[model samples]
Target: MFKKLLLVVFIAAISCTKNDGFQPNGDVLSIIPLEKCENGFAGEYPCNDYDLLDYISLEEIGGIGTKGNDCWGWTDPLDNKEYALMGTNKGITFIDITNPTEVVILGTLATRTVNSSWRDVKVHNTVAYVVSEAADHGMQIFNLEKLRNVTNPPVVFESDYDYTGFGSAHNIVINKTKDYVYPVGTTRSGTYKGGPLFINIEDPANPIDEGGFINYSHDAQVVTYNGPDTEHQGKEILIGSNEVEVVIVDITDKSNPIKLSAISYSNVEYTHQGWFTEDFKYFILGDELDELRKGLNTRTIVFDFTDLDNPVHHFDYSGSSAAVDHNGYVKGNTYYLANYTAGVRMLDISNIENKTITEVGYFDTYPDNDMAAFNGVWNVYPYFPSGNIIVSDINSGFFVIRKSGS
Candidate 1:
């Protein structure tokens, strides 16, 4: 009773406290492709099988007091050049990381308003869409193809277009198959009450805000359904990470989105974010307050999403650290997790059907302690074609890592 009441009353006060950079240069922190993790330590950062390719500090990117938030990757189809699109407290930063040995800072775009601790970025086709918790900070769209035109090192870039459909969003998800961007966690007192604002981004620069879902969503993932569910196949589905429960909605029809189902677990602290397996059979979720409130190690929840109308809890996997688990993503048979203090953990989900999962490797960016505090890696991107992973730390800034001796 006390835990629930305290969470209801005290969480609102604590969640509003936001405090909040980028640096690029070989001078800050740089390790080449040879820092092997033989003795479980890559340079000074702890690791297992991943080596530190490059590191960019907050000071080098003009983010002295700001912290890193979220990140996404973009590969130029015209030339196959990979770039890292990262978010900070103040703005969004872009870096050309094709050459891991000599990572170049392409540029950065300032926030639409004041600096806020929460900022998120996503990409579709050739454009990047950015959103944040800053007041009146509308969505900032940038044409990513311009990166090839940047001859200088790191310059300040501006948004090609800004969509003012909503303000102060926490995150954004893109359904690439349909060219729609859903901006969620907007103002609580607004029309949709913090749900996802359905905006068509087919044109990239000019966005059309049609409508939104009628509930709150902290983060979400939308995809064209090709799962085992035959009835809902070929439709656009949205799995939302609500504060308490996971809500599945059929968003194929933008004007009339139908809620398929909602599910909650045994100990629901705060459903921060989750990701579907590559096969779209299971959903792995991370609750932000589970470690802090329950006094447990990193606990990851998995759910079988075979039937969209009735999802069931699969199993729970406990990590090897007391650090809090935040954002997580699955690529192929591996799960890339961003742990606040434990850094990024790589879990092998090849045998997920048997309810078995294992942590294959880990790279600890914060070696001090593995508490549930929020001072370590904020996000990780593993979709680069060259296998170079992007790690954005809240304190350490940006990093590019790859498999040792690969």
Candidate 2:
């Protein structure tokens, strides 16, 4: 009878291998081939011009129990290999997506603290800087180059450096151009009131805590000013998506960050995230709760940052679906938006001056419904040089998509 019970326990453990929660490592399933979008679907996923190259389910990325949050990409300059860094409820999973169809699960860096639904990652100088909303989870910095020489598969990795300067950050933004890492949404009562905590990551391993902004910024994009604003030319500017208002700061001087302007819209729900156009002439803003609160479609507001001191509201571009827009980034004229239920939608902003932006392509990961609820993609990284777009779905997992021909 004891031997039979032991046999049953062994079988149960095998069955539970796919279960969620910390699983130490992940399983690498068969690679999915490229499926072109036909009619209204790409394989089983609903898509348009965008074709699904491959998909790594949350279970395969981590475990069946874990859900994905944010995602970012890193391209190794040595071999020109692209990797997808996907955030899970527990930790961040790295995958070699150089060959999207036949990708491999490189490894995972478990969260510093307890698992939470919110985790973010950004890469700089081949090092991935991760953050999570989990309690006491400050920042986990892992050497991404270590991925190149992995002898065994799906190895459980450790952080090279852990900084406790501030705990629990919502997002980590790296201004590669300026070589500074900004951790936003920190402790609300901290020095900057949850704004941007500037940490100079010039030395990727050892980061220096410079200072922070005081406007309570939830999300921001910092860039070296080369916009139409001649007054602030060549300055390091930060466009922050503060809750109730959009605040622009001149972070050139770490000791004294200057607030250039703070602007607000009419139906402001929650200023979630946004990105600037390549020309720096316009800034696209996404209000997280505007859809549910105002009963509106996915509305993306555009701001004309021509003048640093006074950013004027350009116009609002309403998407066909009512899915809440979580995060978006502008790559040239294309705006890659992670519309919650609508999946990853690509908008063309080539004609922003005339206020004409159109949705070029989209892949709806959540086929249930395009409601205002947050159930689909949390973030998208479209800046990969290979033209491969990687999206992080809250329910599904990681999606590697690209233009039909590209």
Clashing pairs in 1: 21-63, 21-66, 22-61, 22-63, 23-60, 23-61
Candidate 1: regions farther than 4 A off: 1-34
Superposed Cα deviation of residue 293, candidate 1 (Å): 0.3
Error of 2 at 224 (Å): 0.7
Q: Which tens-of-lDDT digit does each residue in 1-406 have in candidate 2?
A: 0011111111223333332111113222222336778898987788889888778888887876899899999887776677899999989998988767666898999999899999999888888899999999998989999989988889999999998888899888877788789999998888888989989888877889998887677889899989899999999999899899899999999999998898999899999888889989999999999999999999999999999899999999999978899999999889999999999899999999999999999998888999999799999998776677899999998888888864
**Candidate 2 has which clashing residue pairs, if any?**
20-65
lDDT of 1 by residue, 1-406 (tens): 0011111111222222121001121112223453557699977789999987777887776556978889899878776677998788878889998666567888999999999989999999999999999999989999898898999868899999998878889999988788899999999899999999999887876788889999899999998999998999999999999999999999989999999999999889999899999778899999999999998889999999999999999999999878999999999999999998999999999999999999999988887889989989999999876678999999888888887755
TM-score, model 2 to reference: 0.91
Q: What TM-score would each prediction reach against the true structure?
A: 0.91, 0.91
Candidate 1 local Cα displacement, residue 9, angstroms? 59
RMSD of 1: 11.6
- Superposed by TM-score, candidate 1 places the C-alpha of residue 140 at a distance from the truth, in angstroms, of 0.4
- What lDDT score belongs to each candidate, Candidate 1 first? 0.86, 0.86
